[model samples]
Target: MKRILSISLLLLFNLGQSRAQSEKKIAFGPYIQQMGTKDAAVCWSTLVGSMTVTDPSGKTDTIREYKQHAIYFQGLKPDTKYSYDVLNDGSNEGKGTLTTFPDKIVPFNFVVIGDTRTRNNVHKKIIEQVTKRDPRFIVNSGDLVSNGWSMKNWESFFEINHDFMKNTPYYPVLGNHEKDSPYYYNFFDLPNNERYYYFTVGDALFIVLDSEGHRTSIPAYTTEGNEDAYWEQSGIEYLKKEKEWLEQVLKLNHQAGFVFIFQHQTLYSVKKSRVEESKKVRAFWGDIFSRYGVQVFLNGHDHHYHHAYDKGVHFITSAGGGAPLYDIDAPQPETVNYKKIEHFINVEVKLDEAVLHVIDIDGNEFDTIKVKRRDVK
Candidate 1:
């Protein structure tokens, strides 16, 4: 009986190897979730039907069966590191990680990275450093890959960011470059079938929007453009739809400590050229943010980072993902705010005010913005 069991195990291993060789390399993720307290969300892909997550408390929870490569995990502990891993079958040891989130609402820390396309080696090194901080989760501002439309480009994105996504629940906003590709909407597992969506973290309402619409005409949604700027039409319809959704979400969280809008394009360009045309976005959405008392609009474009006061809208651009920086044309547009950098933002939400740090590729702090929620009122 022992001999027979050993033979069976050997055969299974061979079959697993063979299957892996035949199957397409399943891509990973760039979005993660971190809520108030110990709550967290994670997503992964498996050749098998489903997977399980074992927490620090020794409690194992099996998530729903997945047809795709991603999903979100929540209800985790904060400010404490936890051990976790991925699984395909019973007791088969797959890769794993040591993960953690910041302690609940009183004060918390999070990292944002955008345009991590070139020198992937550098990006990996940067991510490794971020993990040491044990942030609750990560926010990818936009331009996750160099080429937005290629399957290979996206696959590379998932491969490079796998370190953060397997354990950390990631949140991604579609960038203009991302629209250059078709795989994005399908590759990511967002709340809605549409690209624009929202999620709440503690005392803040984080609204992710599409800025291309701030520049061009909206794409038609009913029928995908196919070759006819499908995204353009779809974007417009979606924004119209999202407008109603935003109204509802704001009404629900009218008193939240901070309200933020994260998107890929800036309402105002860094060079400040074509101000009249670009300003329409702020003309279109900035008022909504102001009316709703949005704290900031987190944006990316122009490959540099900067911030400024445009009326009541606070604009931020953290594009420094090593994706070939652009020589920004200054003077910007007719709208409220603009800036550029190859960096990210480390945001801390507080009772008295909210703080934002413009951080560099190595997690170095460049500048800071301290805003009082009371003043907005």
Candidate 2:
């Protein structure tokens, strides 16, 4: 009897060990995505395993492998809240809430943040403040991670944003720091061609443009003098195609009550170093924004807050999410206001106009811009 009892205990120990090994732990997300009037998606990742490698210098690196999972829902009610559990195994880790976008014209509010790369503490604080506002959704005008190719960086990003993103849908623009990684595409479920797309909330149109065309390496044989030319020509075709698409989208949505455009690069930079580049960008998309009545053109790249007005379009650089701040040394002719501080914008869309309250990390409102709704025929 004693021997049998000992054997039973050993078997139970092994069973418990197996169960523990088999249990799944969420590594990222279980966050809301692809939010629309009647459909939504919840995505999550789980650590599957890890591998260690030793370099020539005897430096060891351990890479964690993760498996991504998503559940999509359809035929849901518009502008309604719903709770979801991806795991449904009595674990809160897999649980989250989501609200669908409204199907009809109505008032709403959303948040815009940019360059939330590095400075996890600051990012967390910004998120805390943004959460208090209870925005319907959030848009990051690129640079979501310092190095989009680094899984570790992404891990930190998702961890910091877990609580807020679990309910609010996130839309991201592509920044240079993203390095055109496949990881960015893997994590996001965007509209249209993904790179450049447009979405609508009632009569308000939100367009995201991919200013950083396809990232490619220069040819080894290219001479130093021709390097810049090669770089320019590499993505010229893609940019042209994207421009055509943008024009078509703008033309089709000309009657939108509110039109907001977002990109990763600025068209009006107050940073001395980036002024020329900004001019080049502005020249490339000459007068298109004014012609299409884009009320606000929001971008990130320069780590500061600068607003400019030209021909009915408001150009804003709100890249104050964490990354080191840069000085506003070159104020352009159209500059309205400039500040070198970390901040985010809360846009409240009402019947007559949309009010943008530019609030800093300390919860101080520094500037406000109101764009009247476009009059429809």
What TM-score fits each model?
A: 0.72, 0.93
Q: Model 2 over residues 104-195: C-alpha lDDT tens digits?
A: 89899999999999899999999999999999999999999999889888989999999999989999999999999988988888888889
In Å, residue 160's CA in model 1 sits off its true spot by 2.0
User: Candidate 1: which stretches are off by over 4 Å?
Assistant: 1-41, 46-67, 70-82, 88-104, 119-122, 180-182, 212-235, 272-277, 332-341, 374-377
- What is candidate 2's CA lDDT for residue 214? 87
Clash pairs (backbone) in predicted model 2: none
Candidate 1 has a TM-score of 0.72
lDDT of 1 by residue, 61-174 (tens): 654322344323455554455444343334423334324433335556667777676667766766776676666567777877766765556656777777666556567777
C-alpha lDDT of candidate 2 relative to the true structure = 0.88
Q: What CA RMSD would you report for each candidate?
A: 11.3, 8.3
Winning model by TM-score: 2
Model 2's TM-score against the true structure: 0.93
Q: Where does candidate 2 have its weakest 10-residue lDDT segment?
A: 1-10
Measured with C-alpha atoms, the lDDT of residue 315 in candidate 1 is: 74
